[model samples]
Target: MTPRNLLAAGLFCGLAVACANPQAELAAHEHYETTGGSMKLALIPPAEQDDDGRYLNLDPEGSHGSIATRLGFFGRRILTPFRAGAGAAEHTTEAQVSIEAADSVQWVGHSTLLVSMHGLHFLTDPIWSNTPSPTPPFGPSRFVPPGLALQDLPYIDFILVSHNHYDHLDVPTLKKLAKQFPDTPFVVPKDNAALLNKHGVNNTIELNWGEQTQIGNLTISCLPAQHWSKRGIGDTRQALWSSWSVTSPNKRFYFGGDSAYFSGYKLIGDALGPFDLVALPIGAYSPRDMMQGSHMNPEEAIKAALDLRATRVLPIHYGTFDLSDEPLDEPLARFETALQTMTNNLSALILKIGERHAF
Candidate 1:
């Protein structure tokens, strides 16, 4: 079958499975109705929650997108020829191993990153699968392979997941990591533990906004992000989504899971400014009316970096999977253009899929 046909077939199968699960659909609708104004959620500060226990975005008005609108976008997108761009120029395994002692960041494709700092290694929002979907061939296929093979990674002290999005929280990759490094902690936002547990990944530390945990010398904090969550038909917003902050004694780093432009960045900067480095998403933002509440465009990402008061900025969430309407290379192109016009001396860290940069 052609690629388009395969995608259509896979989507049909997935829909069929979802339809077969009547209880899940009913639960979803029930949750939505009960959530009415406030919601029931956990691991969050009371201030961030509603009277009924549902989690709320910093922007009360924030929304993922209308279902009809998204369906329209998907319909239009599927009809067009899929264009998998020339993949990123990945580096070698030896290069990855060489970054052990020095503080470094390696882009492993999409939001997957290998960050080593202060004697410990960290993997952020890891997804090594060719497709970021439970139902394969139905979702966007990875245009390039990961920068470093899973076996090439140094000892990972912590695996941080920012949200429940398929691209950020891939089960296959997490399962492999669980097997490879059984002792490492899998940190995630509140209410996400069950999913990992269901997949046999029992070593998880879940947190909510304003919550944190310590591993070795590092302090990992779960912060807010303007985004929504949904892994199945009716699981929308049932789990918390967040950005993350990892701080050692001398250096600090921020990994933005996925978020739209919001005033919360300024709040975060005021509370935890002067981050040494920040990784922000610069893709999957188009049809502004629909995406403005979820993903940030390139310029907004740059502004987020400045808001975080980051000394160095790394662009991510692009050039791997075709998740939105923008051209694959457009994010970086616009990022570079925005950087050239910046008044601050914020350094830009650009890397190929497998390339590593030491700080």
Candidate 2:
């Protein structure tokens, strides 16, 4: 089948599955009705059209190319039962290492980070599921297991969610985390409070951009990110997206939660300069013509690091899932090339999937 045909089939399948699931359909309608707010979603111009005059939606942009075709290729190559066994083994190894560490941060695959500081543990965008789709049966499945399993994580004092996208906000993962750390507080974007509430996540605090809250001795401030958010197709931009500046008495860290290159980085730098570390997304961007507006390529990711003036940069959001056209290693390779071209004093600390870094 052609790429276009595959894309259509995937969409049709997803839509049909959504419609058949009464709970999903009801959730979609109820979410839109309550969270649509006064923001005129209808007034916003229709998505820009491509040459074919079809509205170019950002969520599944370039759906026909890398997303549909390459994913299909991998989906067929990997055997489900074997993959499950391997995933379990990998998860066990990483969890043992993470739990054994005395004072270090573990990259729990993708944007998930577990920071251990001042006797407190924090998890960022913790998605332990094999796939980041709304339904377990479809969408971007993890090629490998999460570095740390949900139950294996230490007593998490707090969880930070940047936005409402499935990749960033997996409801099942959150439900599991909530169950494990029953009283642990959750920090998320202001408008997304309802979604968590619906899932029985009561210990959630919503913050708009520039707002700060304290968890133990750590002071976390939500900073601006050049990204958009939505859980369903029609509820785009209903919630805000943001990076976060987490400061403790001894250290300051920045987590750039998936953003396009934008002036917001400079603003963040001006306000919160000389961070001890910055965790930035460095993948899932391809066919720049379509992705440049919402996702940053490697070079742009470097620029964001420079703008933030971080002492050490840790790249995330790559190497775990195949979300774009670029080769799996392209983002890191491009990052190295960009580093050589830079005259500024910027450095990066790239971690292996199960690696731990002491800050």
Q: Give the CA lDDT, 0 to 100, for residue 257 in model 1.
A: 84
**CA RMSD for every model?**
8.9, 9.9
Residue pairs clashing in model 2 are: none
How accurate locally is residue 44 in candidate 1, as Cα lDDT from 0 to 100? 29
Indicate the residue-level lDDT of 4 in model 1: 62
Estimate, for each residue in 144-205, the C-alpha lDDT of model 2 and write its tens digit: 66776566666787889987777788788899888877778888866777899999988788
Estimate every model's Cα lDDT from 0 to 1. Answer: 0.75, 0.66
Candidate with best TM-score = 1
lDDT of 2 at 295: 75
**Model 1 alpha-carbon drift over 4 Å, by segment:** 1-47, 51-53, 63-68, 77-81, 86-97
Error of 1 at 11 (Å): 7.2
lDDT of 1: 0.75
Clashing pairs in 1: 39-52, 39-53, 39-54, 40-52, 40-53, 40-54, 41-53, 147-354
